[model samples]
Target chain A: MNGDDRWDDDARAAYQLPIEGEEQARDRAILRLRRESAKRRTGMGAWWVDPDGLRMRPALAAVCVLAVLVIGAWSGAGWMASRGVRAPRPSIATLPSGSTAVTFVFRAPGATRVSLVGDFNGWDPEATPLARATTGEIWIAQVPLEHGLHAYAFVIDGRDWAPDPSAPLAPVATFGRRNSLLVVGEDQAL
Target chain B: MRRLLALALASSLLAPGRASGDESEEARLRARLKPELATPVIEVVRSAAAQGLPTAPLVARALEGASRQAGDEAILEAVRGYAAGLAAARRALGSTARAAELDAGAGALMAGVPEDSLASLKRARPSGSLVIPLVVLSDFVARGVPVANASNAVLAATRAGAADPALLRMRERIDERILRGEAPTGASREGLRELLMKTPGTPKERGSREPRERRQP
Candidate 1:
């Protein structure tokens, strides 16, 4: 038999045997109870009254709180970073000095009506429709330009965007189709 | 409801400003078309010829076309005036005419002098043929001349041809203002025409004055 097996058997036998010395057994039980009670009291004292124990406990608590705060801040920053960049708001465009007039010309063979919209005229689509020229092209009603650069575009037949062919081209497109930028000088170039 | 009310109020306020802008533009156009301001194409062409310049007949053709298109007598006259002046200046210098000379001629024509009179004045004094004198006159009239000229140097071009029929219309208007005794110093022939246009169908007494701008050399 293995040593552990023999030892287990012996323990079982010993447990099963009745105590021949009742006075000795009673003394051992009382001693065991007193030792257990002393240990519990010492544990409670360490929690409530021991200075070193209190200091160590508070330090551990602080470490845990700091870890939680760091995690929360990092998570919040990550969320903000993932949101991407916001677009710029459009400003009401004003003409610079010397600009007096602007002419818009659109070449759309299929279009029946063409209208211009921009920060000027409050983006009103129905305001002024372009008249058809002899070549089936569309031209604007004589628009008096303000001084400065203006961004505008043509809306053809209420659906499509058509840029002006005759006007100077603009590369910037922060809004819709590339806008027509017109620079009105201080003096009219008639 | 509140937003709609705010929008309505805002639009109502904006409407007056827009209307004012339109009225001003119309007024400016009306001023441009006054009958007394009109200068004939033939006088302009003949004036340039006198200056040893040649102008194509294309300008005349354009004037005639514009006249036909414009039923308003005043507008027709102004377009014809501009065309005539351009032709006369072009004839004087041909394609080789300097930009400064062209500008001066245009400014004078805009001021309402007959082209023939302008040519005769230029011939009367050798100084008038030069660009500097015409530029100065343009400046005195508050018009831009592409060339450089000191304030003292420019002189008026000549006027001698069939008396401008348009001048008679302008004369009545000028006499009205003169009777009322408005300051006559800065008044232009074109300005007088504009006044007459405003008082259309109102016959007034006629009077004449010496040409306000004469070459002094």
Candidate 2:
């Protein structure tokens, strides 16, 4: 046995040597690699569309719920606008105790004067006057009113009594003239 | 010493701080109205205030009359009548009724709704605010629905647990129907039917009650 022949024999023995479960170990390694590859593919791409069905992490679920709520609210607001329903402006602000500052707006073009008269101001036309906007016919006034129901009307030019077109009409036409009704607080009747 | 005590009493009575709400309200009336008119109106308001009824509405009524250029007699009559209405409303709505509720109830009473109907309404919604229901009832009457029909509709709706927004929506729908040429009574009935149908937990049969035709106003 020369050195070449001995080397050849040692190589063959090394290649053929198997202690136990060699085939099973090789098969398990192959299976693990396949699973790892599958996991890598699924985890990196759109896991939402996984054939196994929908599954989501906690963060993802929260985001999806938030998106749904925002979209629903947006669509509802659009629907309301389309129906000519104007959301009441958040114009009422807390002022001094027992009173809230409420903004009243009316449009009167070519008017010399406009005044707000209601139970809050003793129905005196001179109590709270609305200022005219420079660009348009809009007249605006912020009046501090006690929390309750009030009957009011606009005095255009200080003589013509006009009920607020946006507000509910009072039931009785006192003095044969209709007045508008306003509810100042959370318990608004109309 | 007697003279000094008399002077002290006079000064105290004349002090601005000593002027009570009733006196100030009288001052406002006197300022805005003729002295002759203010005296009687103030009496009515003071009497009402003493009876635990709201006086603001009475004073407001008188002032509104004056602002509208109404006659002194008309103003006096309006104030007296309003005070009477407030008393009646307080009776019907119970003593615990809020001021806004009383005001709305008085309007409903003045709109031809019977006192018993007002009582029935308070009975129907014992815990909730009756302002919207009472206002709606008055609105219906003002729009030409017979008082009986209006009262029945509102009572039924309130008893059925219709919220304020629902009642207001019903009012808008009825107003639209009236503007479209439907009789007020018919519009109100149909509006109530629609409301009952939509209100949660409302019985099915309650919305299908027989309708009575009322004379068109």
**i-RMS, every candidate?**
18.5, 1.4
In terms of docking quality, model 1 is incorrect
Chain B TM-scores per candidate, in order, are 0.28, 0.87
Steric collisions counted per model? 17, 0
- Candidate 1: lDDT of A47? 49
C-alpha lDDT values of all predictions: 0.44, 0.81
Model 2: per-residue Cα lDDT over B1-217, one tens digit each:
9999999998888776535777778888999999889889999988998899999899999989998999999999989988999999999999999999899888888877889888988887899888888877877887788788888888888888898889888888987898789998889889999999999998777788743222221
User: Which candidate number would show the highest TM-score if scored against the true structure?
Assistant: 2
- Scanning candidate 2 chain A in windows of ten residues, the lowest lDDT window is A80-89
lDDT of 1 by residue, B122-165 (tens): 55443323243343243333322111111111221122221222
**Residue B32 Cα positional deviation in candidate 2, in Å, after optimal superposition:** 1.0
Task: Estimate how well candidate 1 is docked, as a DockQ score.
Answer: 0.00
Residue A159 displacement (Å), model 1 = 1.6
- For model 1, what is the C-alpha lDDT against the true structure? 0.44
